[model samples]
Target: MKNTKTPDLPLSIRAIIVAFRVFFHLGWTKISKKLGTDPTTVQKFFQCMQRLANGSEDFWYLLSHIEPSGCHHPAPLIAPGSEESLEVRKAVLKHKTWMRNNAVNYERSKANLPPLKCTTVQNICLDFKHAAANPKYPKRIKRKRQPCKTALDEEDRSNWLQYTQDLEEAEAESDILTNELANKLKDQIQKLKDTVSQQQKNAESPGTLEWELLQQKNMEICAYNDAHFTPA
Candidate 1:
């Protein structure tokens, strides 16, 4: 069964939220004010996200369905692996601006320094979710089963004979006393089974004391496992 626990939003989305979560960690009405987008757009973003969480979406497919204007972009038109994602580029640009203002200023701003930006890692959690749901990827190949041997090896056959002989001896030794006890247990068990079946037929609910006693008898039968008739 699939786990139903709600997972945390990805770090990229969490970072985006952090940018706008100040003051009250408020509703989209307030957060959208920080995001410079309308509250309705925020509502739709989460609506789509809830659908995605419920295993109802693919990666880019889910994003494509979102209100594109909310992110200032339409469906993905950028070539995969050819151009940086718009979100990553924005984060990188923000980092470079921060570095130029804070870090570089400690020396001399723009002192012939190379262009700076944070190296944004490609986020693949959505792809993982989509593949886990729809499974477009290949699974591991299974090995073919080998044919069974026609006959046991000599040592194995000899061991098997000894084991069987010992088992027979054990059974013979136990049988005499076990037979009489077994017959008594068998009648007692049959009575229990019939009574239990009748109790189940009579019960209004399954959890009454009579039902529990019936279940206990079934458990006892399983534990006892009669000789020959119901092999242990």
Candidate 2:
């Protein structure tokens, strides 16, 4: 008989390996486009892949057995502290309260109750002070005001006004140049039109051979139009 048993791998390591293979095959661009994730995340996936490849078999075995069904529910809140740290303290207090209440109920059923010594009231002021002293917290931003302007500043204002006036004069000069060119072009066009009209009149003069030829061409065009464009 041939030995054909496959070695067992951890679910977590196997998941990471699978994830790496999928990411590697997809590449950065395709992964980013398809998943709407950054390339850095894709790069991190490759790093994870490398670690799995070099790591121990136990890691792979542990990963393969892992399942989402074992997830724990979050504890309920019971602490009554400041609004910011209320949730954290509440969770701790709720756990304490649950234990104490359960113990008292159990003892009452047995006709032997134990006095509770647990206290949930915490001094969160010290925690707040420590947090405030931490450098990670953002400092209050201060707004700076603009310095007051004096009478001597009027000279600077006048200089800016003069600069704007010079800019406007330059723009006006450009507009005048454009208008002059347009007028010149219009005059030239009109002159050309007049010259063409004079030439047409000269060609159409009575007794000219060109005039007779034009009449013959017109007659041919009329005949062609009559033949091709007749009413149905």
Best prediction by TM-score: 2
What TM-score does candidate 2 reach?
0.27
lDDT of 1 by residue, 9-53 (tens): 344543354344332456878765555556665555665554644
Model 2 lDDT, residue 65, Cα: 37
Candidate of highest lDDT: 2
Off by over 4 Å in 1: 1-147, 179-232
Candidate 2: tens digits of C-alpha lDDT, residues 1-232 = 5322212323443365445444456565565454444555545544554554554335454354334332223434333233423432333333443443343334444545332223322322125542344343322212222344556488888998999999999999999999999999999999999987876886779777667878889999999999999989
